[model samples]
Target chain A: MQGLFVVFRKELCDHFSSYRFVILFGLIAMVSFITSYMAGVHMKENLEALSKTRFSFLMLFSTPGALFSMVQFVSFFGPLIGLVLGFDSINRERAQGTLIKLVSQPIYRDAVINGKFLAGVATISILLVSIVLVISGFGLALVGVVPGIEEIWRLFIYLIISIFYISLWLGVSILFSILFKSIATSSLASVALWIFLSFFVTLGAEVAANAIAPMDRKKETKPEILIKNTRIKERVSLSSPMVLYSKATEIIINPMRKTTGSIVMMMPMEQILSSRFQNPLPLGQSVIIVFPHMTALIAITLICFAISYLVFIKQEIRT
Target chain B: MDADTIIQTVNLTKRYGKQVAVDDLNLSVKEGEIFGFLGPNGAGKTTTLLMLLGLSQPSEGSASLYGLDPLRKATEVKRLVGYLPENVGFYEDLDAIQSLEYVANLNGINKEEALGKIDKLLELVGLKNDARKKINAFSRGMRQRLGIAEVIIKDPKILFLDEPTLGLDPEGAIWFMDFIASLNRDRKITVLLSSHNLSQVQKISHRVGIMINGKMVADGSMESLAREKFGVGDKEYSLEEIYMEYFQEV
Candidate 1:
């Protein structure tokens, strides 16, 4: 633990001093602030539409604007911040001939990986907190409403979820760093994997859903088939880190969000509508709603961390 | 192992598939002695060093540092030793003092202690004036000098330096040698200097091990190897001749 702290402190300082953090912080801050302002504006329209005189100002974070909402933007760009910070974490040290020197210190090799992962998580945590505070503060003025206590609690939970989501990407990028020798290879491979997982997965999910449960509008008149198609489509897309994060964040930020499943056969139209349009589910319900999504992200992140740790410890430091 | 031996290896071997990197090697270095390890390219010098540092596992046999197996007790072994690799570098953005102080903290040295020790060590390495300069502005020799400071930051019981002067100019090489000699003599720090440069090794080494094709071809003092190879009372011959005699291509 002592060695971990030592490595963490130095790594955090390294991030602060490096241009990588400066550029990422600037990029995220700019895009997120812009999205927040737009979301703040859109929250006004949502309030008037819903005809709710009193709603959670926290909804501003989830309100979809002309282009994108803040949480959507976070879902899109959060991984960028994570990948950029971690793609070269270990290989860069090796290239600079510092890895041998580092391991030769009294600290265990595990300390280095632990410190690096913690530092990345810490960076993501700070970035998310700032985004939430800024957007929430700005929402108060633009939307002319104070957030409810429950909304504030949900937002805090969302922040924790956001950290885990970003850490998933950090873990992936660090895994590449250890697996590859050159920084160029690792960074390029990280970005390539990011593109595949973030963009292609969404497209592929649609294709796979169509193939698995084709509409076949001609004979498949059964409503169950359509329902199954929708569920499969949602499942395929939600498997992605982007969709999982957006799903989790959307429910947390928009307290009104109720169920994540499609229920045509299970409930009559009137009953489904009443439940869906009902007042925001209790805090516990909302948490339960997103718990699976959050767990998947956290589980994958831990798996990545585990693989990187095992490979790094067993790796030969020839130089 | 002798009572005075700080490092002991018996029948230690490492092989990559069909090729052996370090054959059944038996070596022991006593406390407070400068042991120079000389080898040609692909002679398994770096591999042997890696095994010693517990970075790579041997296919057979074992090695110990101060009676502790480095593989099982790596942190304990590392705590008592320092290593300076060839072509060592610092984070180009960090100044010398910042870099050293950062490593010192990793060694569990307190900030106040690190600050003071870093200042004096930088002076010892003749890099005191460049403490605040970014590493990018420093030359190779300056970086090597800083590498020395980083190695001794915790004042380990022994130092493992592999080609520490590999790329230095003649003057820089001399300065590095003098600095290392001072560390070994004045501080009584055990030194294991590995290099292909026979002259530098002969200058500071009390004993020498010459490795060829993953095996120790010879191990002894200069005179001992000289007499043994060419018989006693042989005419003058530098360590280079002794090396070329065993390694000559012709």
Candidate 2:
């Protein structure tokens, strides 16, 4: 345990002093602030109508800017922060020959992997907390809206979900670092997985839905087939951590969001017209909606970390 | 097992799938002796060293350092042993002092104590002037010297060095060998020196082991090995000669 703390402190210092940390932090913080600032300005412009709305402060995160809202930006690119931090975590040490020297110390093998993971998590937490604080400060200044207690709680939960989402990628990249021997291979593989899971998985889900329940325009498609298509698409998309993360975070940040299922199925002509009078669900209900998503995100992240841990412990540090 | 034996392996073996890396073998080094570990590449010298250090698990038999099973009591065994790999590495971004301090902290040394010892160690390794220099700017000989300082930071009971002088010039290698011999003499740190440089190993080793094809073909003092193999009186055989004879027979 003492060894774990020693390695953790060393790795944390390494991460902080690294140039890549500065670059990645600057990149993410700049983009997030830009999107949130735009959202704040956009909300301020429509202040008269939005002032009466509950939890209006959260619009800074959910309201779209020129291209994406703050939430969308995080969902799409936050994995890059995680992947960059961890893709070469183990292999770089191996290549540098530091790993053998490290493990040869009077420390348990598990300490090295556990300490590295905890350090990465700490780095990610620091990055996320500062960004969230900066965005909230900007939002408060621009929108002139003081968040209520419930709004603060929602924002805090959003931050937690975002960290988990990004950490899933961190675990995955660290796993790749252990499984592959070359830094190039691990980094490339991490990026490829990120691209496929976050961006291409949506396309893949659509394609899978079409194959499973294709809608033939020649004849009127059955309602059952339409429903099945939506279900299949949702099911397939859920396989991606990005999809699960975005869905969970969107609901957590926006208390008005009612369900995680297909929005198409949840809406109909009359329901939309009548839904205006429906009160926004409370935080407890919002949490209930995304509980499954959160559990799955946490589960996959743990599994990734566990596998990497086992492989590293059992591996021979020959290099 | 002798009471004074600080390192011992009993029928230790390692198999990488169908191919054997280190075959069943018995080897031991006594306390305060410079035992040379000589073998050609792929003769399992590195593999044996790794197993002895508890970095690799043996498929058969057992190894003990100070009567503690290396596999079961790895941390304890490691606390008493220090290993300097063929190409020992340090964090390139850290200076010599910072690098040694990290090793010191890993061994549970306090900051003040570590800082004080690191200064003396840098001087001992003749890197006093470069103590503040980053490892990236260091020459190979300088890095090896820093590596020597790193291994002995914990003041271990034994030291295992693999190809310690591999990249040094002749003069540098000789100097490094003498430094190691002096460490053994002054600190009584049992040394297991593995190298391809037969003459250098022969220069300082009190006893030597020659391994081939994962097996220890010959192990003993130089005179005893020559007397047993040649059965001649007053005959001398260098480690290079004995090493070549084993390779020829294999």
Specify the CAPRI tier of model 1: medium
Give per-residue lDDT, candidate 1, residue B116: 92
Clashing pairs in 1: none
Candidate 2 lDDT, tens digit per residue, A1-319? Answer: 9899999999999999999999999999999998988888888888897656788888899999878999999999999989998999999999999999999999999999999999999999999999999988888878888989999999889888888888889999999999999999999999999999888988999999999999998999999899899999999999999999999998999877788876557658636853775578889999998999999999998898999999999898997
* lDDT, each prediction: 0.85, 0.91
Kindly report which residue stretches of model 2 are placed more than 4 angstroms away from their true locations once superposed. Answer: A267-274
lDDT by residue (B106-142, candidate 2, tens digit) is: 9999999999999999889999999999899999999
TM-score for each predicted model, relative to the true structure: 0.95, 0.98
Best by TM-score: 2
lDDT of 1 by residue, A1-319 (tens): 8899989988887777788888888888887778777777666666767676345576577666658877888888889988988999999998887888888889988999999999989988887798678777777777788877887898889888888888888999999999999999999999998888889988998788788878886775567778777777787888688888888888777766666654553468756675767676678888898899889988988998999999998888864
Candidate of highest lDDT: 2
Recovered native contacts in candidate 2, as a fraction?
0.83
Q: Mark the 10 consecutive residues where model 2 chain B has the least summed lDDT.
A: B227-236
DockQ of each: 0.80, 0.88
Positional deviation of residue A57's Cα in model 2 after best superposition, in angstroms: 0.8
Q: What is the TM-score of chain B in candidate 1?
A: 0.97
Model no. 1, DockQ: 0.80
